[model samples]
Target: MAQEKEIHFTGYEKQISNWTDLIPAERFTLLVLQTLTEVSKDPRGTYITNDRLSNIIGLSPTRISSTITKLKKKGYITVQRVGATGRYIKTRDYNHATLYTYH
Candidate 1:
């Protein structure tokens, strides 16, 4: 069985309101919103590949990728930090890691 992780949203009120107002038409954006909310809590910063997010949210990786791209285009998030190149090697096959901050 996959161990479930409980996500507590602490710093996500104004942004929630902002996002809701800015992109009410994008329905599936909530999943991406909540997922980013969960990861944004890491003080050391965080990064999520589509595969990891797909596993956590029970969606296909393609969906996660598209949502991420859309979120970036919408300007709701900004890359705050990034890891070294090849950081995801021998892991999820991603080339690097990026930490995003919500607006």
Candidate 2:
């Protein structure tokens, strides 16, 4: 069997060095968010749902939601609501995922 390739995150030191105030969960979530942003290779952001984040981080959806809000409040990330058609817009015409841009 072929072994899966391991993935690594770059610039992690810069991400965590200045944020000594972060709790464990917040730090882990921020790292994951930064990794996702880099992997997506999009300047806009990474489009994701709370359920997906929960699965990846092994956190409850509610917990993940609150963590994300905390990150936003700390200016570590910016979130933009995406429409059903995958466009950023003012109106929430339907349920949609959010695009997370890591700072």
Candidate 3:
């Protein structure tokens, strides 16, 4: 029998809590987006799976899926499904968009 490896995450609690109030509607979606952003900032592009995301954020797949759909609908993120793999792309340029300003 093989011993299971333990994953340790330090300081992530604060990051997750900070996003609780900033997300538009669903916190899970925000969590996923924020995690993806952090990963993208790294020199190595990290490919995260839906199961890994759900486990890391302590949310169910159904919840994550629902949030993903909402974020996609709002154009905040892009999800590419190629066969069994799903890729998530966050629109970091949203700040430059004119939707936030009063017209």
* Candidate with the greatest TM-score versus the true structure: 2
Model-by-model lDDT, in order? 0.47, 0.66, 0.56
Give each model a TM-score. Answer: 0.44, 0.67, 0.53
Model 1: CA > 4 A from native: 1-8, 11-18, 21-44, 79-103
| Two-way lDDT contest, 1 vs 2, winner | 2
Which residues of candidate 3, in runs, are more than 4 Å off? 1-25, 41-46, 98-103
Clash-forming residue pairs, model 3: none
Q: How would you encode candidate 2's per-residue C-alpha lDDT over 1-103 as one tens digit per residue?
A: 9998644454563446456778888888887777677667556667777788899999998998899888778777777766763421111111232342235
By TM-score, is 1 or 2 better? 2
TM-score, predicted candidate 2 vs. hidden true structure: 0.67
lDDT of 1: 0.47
Which lDDT tens digits does candidate 3 get at residues 1-103? 9998644242233443444334634554554565666668643323567677678777787776776677667665666554677564553443465534321
All predictions: root-mean-square deviation over Cα?
11.6, 10.4, 11.2
